[model samples]
Target: MRDAETVTFGGSALNRAAELRARPDEIAALLNDPAARAVPLWRGKPSIDGAGALGWVAANHPVLRDGEEPAIFLGSDETGPLFTIDLSAWQPETGADPVPASFFDATEQRHPGLPDGHRFAELRNIMADLSARDAECAATAKALIGWHRSHRFCSACGEESGVAQAGWQRVCGACGAVHFPRTDPVVIMLITRGNSALLGRSPGWPEGMYSCLAGFMEPGETMEAAVRREVMEETRVRVGAVRYLASQPWPYPSSLMLGAVGEALDETIILDPNELEAARWVSREDMARAFAGDHPEIRAPRRGAIAGFILRNWLADRLD
Candidate 1:
């Protein structure tokens, strides 16, 4: 596989086995199979061990007993069929609760039922350390479970929806409306002109941390167009000749980040205060220092994010 394809939360090529979603009996039997294992999540955080590997427990493990919903069928591998169970209902100790509305949550929650090192850790904190297969599985589990939590009611009719297809879908009993998981597409572009790259920081991001500008794709807009539009709207930077580089399944509430590079037509930056707290152009040399943790006023983008992936590739001339 190309280096670009190995971005975190992608390129695992796991057999999703979508056909099996409709087979309820087969899925039920697989749940009982001794070889089947499940990854558990507590309030959107997955269990990770001290070694940074995702912790898996047998499907019938006591830690999974309290989830209000059925286990989500991820896919099959040589080990057997894989599943994920949501334990959001499992609350932690009083002081260990997650901070509300924080940009980064460093709190770790350990269930009494789980082993000592198997604590539910924030995905972003451990994302760079997970194996490709573990990253894919964790992303899939987080996205699917989050979708279910937010979409419990049918939009067509104000009726509560029920889990169906082993968590792949929701069925509205009142209106008979069937719904599938939604993935919002966001374009994150590394816009460049000459030796400098345009980078921006959002309001709540940590100080001195800047990354490629990104925004959600509007309806009926193409990826290239989204890239141009977002940059222009946020920084008034006109972008031309956009090209796709890579993609990552960012499951912080389920977004597929479309990574791209755009040539900047001008060096002028007019920042919209509402969209960006600050914006600047950094030369290749300064960016290298940021990545190496040597820059005094600038910090590197979050590790395992597509922004960092694309920027690193651009710096190495490996975006191909």
Candidate 2:
């Protein structure tokens, strides 16, 4: 994981301006500055122009609603003033009696003013051809917008909340509580024993698609422990001595994938059907074939995803 921060969006190291979020004056300064730009959100998706999808901000100044202000200024890249916009004032551009699209998926309703690519997909398949910078922008946009949608209610008081911290936090007027966007931690591991690795398929995955075994890290669990526990719980493969490999900020609603390479003490898989449709051991040779698209029955993981990155490195023997 030495080059972890070097990975795609992981590399940006944006300062995320946490301290500035709480100060109303600082937030106002950033918003009113001509250099400050707003990244548009349609439904929960980030608006993408061509260039790989991550960096574009909305051209218009966003109007704040309900006494809420911006929170969470995701620090600067080479771009100037990389601030997020919270449109609690958003109303569907649809017909009379328009409502917020956050209540449902709005990927199909293309806004006439926005770029065609400014939308969401379950997988960022479009990023396959985008430049590194665009991909980072796309990832940031998706993560922030999704955070806004899910945090409309205050966790502390269960009262309806409004955006603050630019677009990174929510505040409840009822009990004077504040909430911030959450990035759930998940552990994805390439479990290995000798020359083979473990991969599993979820019930609804595309035919022949298999990738690293992953599970969410529970509260108070260390990254290494989460790796071992998840591997054991899903495939009954006891793992020992987990080693951190790399990570990806999978912004499909905000998850930070903690990728690792784990030494499997035992290989016999007792798959919990509820967790996987099938679990199996694949030799390095077969994995290479899958990577090359030569395997008749299996497909390697999709590129730009953490699973694919892990598998590619494992094949290159770079995980060491």
Candidate 3:
């Protein structure tokens, strides 16, 4: 766990500029600054350049226009200021990344200023490849954008909400209600009793691809309690001595992954069909092989994931 913060999208330490975001004029000033930069998203996919890095455009890039309301202020870096603009409405001329045919609104969008080979890449596909700072910025923007899309209406009064607080909040002009973005808490546990740890796969995951037992923490539930409950509910393996290990920001629509290590009191796993498709214990040596891509039957959790982080640390005896 020496380099625990290196976990993908775990802790990039972006400044966020909370005070600057509170000033209406500063927000506008930053947006208009010549040195300011912006990241573009089409159908929620990030723009990537030929170098396989985030393709940040100048604030004045033609793809950015003033008419777009709710332009999210993503805070400033050493490069002056930053923002994000959703270009989903703009149609591409040619040679753009095609929206997945399965998408509800299928179309391709490519910005003219972007290099010929530059295109929108889904974060999930490129997260592991991105530098820690780039990954954190992109994930933060994605989560904020998604929140704006889904929470445009006031939850309390059922009225429309206007973007406020430099893209961090929505204000209902009608009822004067203010709402903030939410981050769902999930507990992903590495439960071990002896030399083996427990892993489980949901119904639709690829065959042999399993991860730590994880679930959303319910109301009034402590993190430790959530871990124990999720383990027992899914596999009937009673867990003890649950404690925090590390955390990751899983920005797939904004969920915080709270990694934990738990001691299993009983190794007998009685799977609950509703919670998991399959659950079992895997020996440490075999798990190590899985991490090295040589396991005969089990596949390691995806790299950069908290599951992988916890498993690797456990294998290395670093979870003390």
Candidate of highest lDDT: 1
Better of 1 and 3 by lDDT: 1
Off by over 4 Å in 2: 55-72, 86-109, 115-123, 127-134
Candidate 2, 51-100: lDDT as tens digits: 54443553334332221344346655555566544343445455522233
Compare candidates 1 and 3 on TM-score and give the better one.
1
Regions more than 4 Å wrong, model 3: 66-68, 91-109
The per-residue C-alpha lDDT of model 3 at residue 266 equals 95
Give a tens-digit lDDT track for model 1, residues 1-320: 15877889975888889999999999999999999999999889999976879988899898798888999999988888899999999879899999758998999988989877899889999999999889999999999999999999999998999999988999999999999999999999999999999999989989899999999999999999999999999999899899988888999899999989999999899999999999999999999999999999999988999998888888988877
State which candidate has the highest TM-score: 1
What are the lDDT figures for the candidates, one per model? Answer: 0.92, 0.70, 0.84
- Work out how many backbone clashes candidate 2 has: 14
lDDT of each residue in 131-177, candidate 3, tens digit only: 88788888888888888888989999999999999889999999999
On the 0 to 100 scale, the lDDT of residue 101 in model 3 is 49
TM-score result, candidate 3: 0.92
Show the colliding residue pairs in model 1.
none
